[model samples]
Target: MSKKVILITGASSGMGKETAKALIQEGHTVYTVARRIDHMQDLKNMGGYPIQMDVTNENDIQNVVDTIIKHESKIDVLWNNAGYGLYGAVEDIPVDEARKQFEVNLFGLATITQKVVPYMRQAKSGTIINTSSMGGKMYTPMGAWYHASKHAVEGFSDCLRLELQEFNIKVVVLEPGVIATEFGEVMLKNISQFSSKGAYSSLTNQLVTATKKMYDKGQGSKPTVISKTVSKIVNETKPKTRYRVGLWAKPMVWMRIYLGDKLFDKIIMSQLS
Candidate 1:
């Protein structure tokens, strides 16, 4: 709202890209970074700077942060949103795949945050919004590694929030539910590639069928929903520590919170395969 400098990762598509557009429209200076720099050309057209970055590469992360600082002096908000869904049974998913999943979703998120926090701390005023998922709060049957990474994000944010309170730096956890992104498609592909013909074929198929039904029926919310959440998180003077948006984010979290793990699992498994 105040023409602040904002940097968002995974801005090549989905909520990150949309949020960059929204923030620029509101007069903020936005630098959107992702591996697919070509996909962000449209963002550049909207007066947002698009930087090519692979969050997994420490050199890329350092260079990106240094470049942003050289130009902007300070970053007002950092959105660590670049991640993909890695869905499969833990037993079926290889150890290497599990490690890579954490590398992207959890470790990468932390790496970018580490680079930015020093700048934010120097300012003594900044917000770090980590894009976690409803999976962080709840669990699903074939999403062991994905869920594990998000849950780590939730806890990681909590600790960072507590530690940074003295510096006036805010760390907010963003939990998006079933949003209309290629995330589901990617998840399906991962399951099919990693576990489709394995011991969990029937279960993965059931999960796929349920997810397909949801996507086919246009049940997922637009990326704009989460874009609006991003705007609110930045604009609010006192944003919540956690904000859950998109379809089913609230109800599913409610089931987990009130119904207890056993009942929640029963309900979710019934809906899946």
Candidate 2:
């Protein structure tokens, strides 16, 4: 396989970090970006280029793009993976916080894609992989904002794939189920605010408790699983438009499609309960 120049966002931890490492091991020039530069120092030590980037900052993204263009001359792959989970009840999460979630998960991702597209167009060949979630297809309680953002990613990626197909630019969506990460801790923190004494307090506490327990028990797949799937997508000559990774991703997607909405909702509710 030809060594490709790849730029991966959110590479400070979890799947992004693992993917960067795997790509580098395969001899690809991996440029990893994230807010915490220190978290990516290990990646740099491993021969992956680390760039301090916050997707919400347009200038930061532009700088990274410009740097890559200047040094690599062209980017062969773009992993739009910078995102977070802002889990809370819709009624409890402030509208501003909800918008911020979209800003980071959806708008920020789109912004980086926009900056990279012209370069890909110039090269006339490139692969764009987006990190969506299983929640993108199947909804879960207390994650309304996060799910909405991911759903937007689902739609955005689909449209982008269609639009960029004629340009020989492949757009792929990576949908992952729960993985052992700091994501659950963040979600639990958000839940505390929503679960504060109120009409929905009981349900909120139940949901938070269940989520925390699942994560604490380490019931989710490892980040390496998703990272391997990403490596295949990056290296394959012909990659699937969507690669659903992790333990529950495929089963949940199947249930969402075949079981219909009512049943799916019941299953999801039961999971939380």
| Candidate of highest TM-score | 1
lDDT of 2 at 25: 94
Off by over 4 Å in 2: none
RMSD of each: 0.8, 1.1
- Candidate number with greatest lDDT: 1
> lDDT tens digits, residues 1-273, model 2?
899999999999888998899999999999999999999989989999999998999999999999999999999999999888887677877999898999999999999999999999988899999999998998887788999999999999999999998889999999998898778887888778765567778778888778878887889999999888998998898899998888689999999999999999899888766
TM-scores vs. true structure, each candidate: 0.98, 0.97
Q: How many residue pairs clash in model 1?
A: 0
Q: Residue 134, candidate 2: how far off, in angstroms?
A: 0.7
lDDT per residue for candidate 1 within 1-273, as digits (tens), equals 477999999999888988899999999999999999999999999899999999999999999999999998999999999999898888888999999999999999999999899989999999999999999999998899999999999999999999999999999999999999889899999999987886899998999999999999999999999999999999988999999989999999999999987899899999984
- lDDT (C-alpha) at residue 182 in model 2: 76
What global local distance difference test value does model 2 have?
0.90
Clashes counted in candidate 2 amount to 0
lDDT score for residue 195 of model 1: 78
